[model samples]
Target: MRIARLDTPAGPRHAVALGDRWHVIASPFAAPLVYTGDSIPADEAVLLASVDPRVVVGIGHNQPGHPLPMQAWHKSVHSVAGSGDDIYAVRDVGTVNIEGELAVVIGTSATNLTLENAFEAVLGYTVANDVTNVDQCPIDQRNFQGKSGKNYTPLGPWIETELADPENVATEVVINGAVVANSGSFNLPSSVAATLVYVTKWLTLEPGDVVLTGAPGTDLPVQPGDTVDITLAGIGTLSNTIA
Candidate 1:
C-alpha cells in the first residue's frame, strides 16, 4: 500500500493510494492504517511530505572514497519539505547541489537493535532529495553541508509499505527533465537493513524518524530555475524546484 499525507478541502489528512485514487486514513505513522472512508481523486489532492519525521538522520560514507566509516548526523526538522516545495539556497553561498537517495522511514521507536531484526522497525521507504549548499570554494573533506537551510530535504510523493529487495531498487536523479544520474541502492556497500542496525546501535530512532540511505553518485548542481526529481522504484517520484 502507498501511504501519504495530503491537503484536502476538509484539511490535511493521511491517505492510502489505491489504483489512481487515494483513500483517506486516520494515521499514517501508525501501523495497520485505519481508513476514514473519505476518498479523493489522486490529482486533486495536494501531496505533502511522505513522513513528518521529528528528526531526519542523514548517513554519509555510503558512497565510495570516503576516508571515514559510515557516519550519521542530525538535520533540523525544519529542513523537511514536500515534493512541490522550493529548495532555497543560502544567499551568496553560490553553491547548491543535490543527492537523490532512498529514504527509510521508521514506524516504531527502536534502540539497540541488531541486524537480525532491524527491518521490523522500518515502516517503509520513500524518495529523498538530499539538497545541500556547498560552503564555499576550495571545498574539501569535513565540509558536509547538511545544515544548508530550510527546504534542503524534500521527501514525498508517498511511501511503499513493502520492499522485497531493498538493494535492487533502481534510482534516478533527473534535473530539468533530464536523467543525469542512474544508480541503485546496491551501490552502497552495506544493505539498508544493516545500515539501520548500525544506526540504531548508537541512537534511539523514534517513529516518523527518517534515515537517508545516501546518494548513488556525485550529482550536478542545481540553480534557481531548475527542478530536481528524485525517483525510486516502488515509491513515487519526489520533485522540487530550486529557488
Candidate 2:
C-alpha cells in the first residue's frame, strides 16, 4: 500500500492512498477521528515527508566504481539536512551537486545483523536527494564534508512496505523533468542486505532510522528554485524545491 502523510482539514494525518481516495490511519501529526471510509480529494491534500526519522545515515561511494577501503566501510557518514528542512545552494561552498539515491527506513532496532536477516529489520523504503557541496573540500574529503552540510538531505513522499527486494529496485533522478541520473538495484556493488549488515555492525539502527544507499555515477549541480525528483520503482517519488 502507498502510505502518505498529508495535511487535512483537521490536521496532518497519516493516510493510505487507495485509488482516487485516501484512508486516514493513525494521526502521527495530530489526534483525530479515525476515518476508515472517509475519502479526501487527492488534489486538495498537501503531501509531507513520509517518515520523521531519529537519525539519517548516509553511505558514501557504496556503488561498484566508487568503492572505499575496507577500513573506512564502518565509518558513520551523513549529510546535514534533517526532515522538513530546505536544502540551499549557497551552503554548498562552490561545487553544489545533488545525488538521487534510494533510502531505506528501519522499522525495528537491529544490532550485529547478518545479511540474511537484514530484510526483516527494514520497515520500508523511500527516495532521498543527497545534496552535496563538491567544492567544500578536496576530492578525497568532499564526500565527508559535502555530506555534513546543513539541510543537505531531503527525504519523504512516504515509506513503502511492500518492497521486499530493495536490492532489485530501480531508481532515477530528474531535474525539471529532464532525466539526469538513472540506475537500478542491479547496478549497486553490494547487496542492500549486505550494506545494512555492514552499517549495523558499527552502530545500532533504531526504529525510523534512514540509510541513503548512494547515488549513481552521474552527479550534477543544482541551484535555487530547481525541482529535484527522486524516484524508486514500486515505492514512490520524492520531489523538493531548492531554495
Candidate 3:
C-alpha cells in the first residue's frame, strides 16, 4: 500500500492510495490503518512529506574509502520538505550538492535492536535528497551547520509499505533532462537492517523518525535553476527545484 500525507480542503490529511483516489486514513502510524472513507482524486490532492519526522538521522561512510564503521549525524527536523518544495541554496555556504538516498521511516519506538529484528520498527520506505553544503561544515566532522539548513531534505511522493528486497531497489538521479547518477541500495556497503541495529544500539528511534541510508558516489553540485528528480524502483520519484 502507498501511504501519503496530502493537503485536503479541510487541512493536511493522512491517506492511503486507493486506485485513482486517496482514501483518508486516521494516521500513517496507526496499526492496521483506519480508513475514513473520505477520498480525493489522486491528481487533485497535493502531496506533503511522507511524514513529519521529529528526528532525522543521517548515515555516512557507507561508501568506499570513507570507513568501515557507520558514521551518523543529526539533522534539524525542520529541514524536511515535500517533493515539490525548493531546496534553497545558502549563499554563504557556496556549493550545494544533491544526494538521492533511500530513507527509512520508523513506525514504532526501537532500542537495543538486533539485525534479525530491526525491520519490525520500520513503517515503510520513502525517497530523500540529502542535500549538502560542504562549505558550512566538513562531511567527515560534526555537521550541525552543514546538514541542518532549512528545507534541505526533500522527501516524498509517498511511502511504500511493501518492499520485497530494499537492498536490490534501483535508484537514479536526473538533473534537468540528463541522468547524473545510476545507483541502488545494493551499492551500500552496509545493509539496512545492520544500519538500523547500529543506530538503535544507542539512540531510540520513535515513530516519525527518519533514517537516511547514505547515497554513494552520486552527489552532484547544483545551480540555482536546476531541477532534480530521484527515482527508486517500486517507490515513486521525488522531484525538487534548486533555488
lDDT against the true structure, per candidate, is: 0.82, 0.70, 0.88
* Residues 179-234 of candidate 1: C-alpha lDDT, one tens digit per residue: 99899888877778778887888999998899988776835688789988888887
* Superposed Cα deviation of residue 187, candidate 2 (Å): 1.4
Q: List where candidate 2 sits over 4 angstroms from the true fold.
A: 8-12, 27-39, 62-86, 139-145, 148-150
Q: How close is candidate 2 to the true structure, as a TM-score?
A: 0.80
Error of 1 at 101 (Å): 0.4
| Model 2 Cα lDDT, one tens digit per residue, 99-218 | 777788787789888977998888778777777777764864525655665556776777687885788888788888999877876676666777788788888988778887766553
Determine which window of 10 residues in candidate 2 has minimal summed lDDT: 69-78
**How well does candidate 3 match the true structure, expressed as C-alpha RMSD?**
1.7
- Candidate 3 residue-wise lDDT at 52: 87
Task: Supply the global lDDT for candidate 1.
Answer: 0.82
Q: What local lDDT score does residue 21 receive in model 3, on the 0 to 100 scale?
A: 95
Return the top candidate by TM-score: 3
Candidate 3 on 181-217: residue-level lDDT in tens? Answer: 9999888888888889989998999998999999866
Residue 214 displacement in candidate 3 (angstroms): 0.5
Top-down lDDT ranking: 3, 1, 2
- What is the TM-score of candidate 1? 0.91
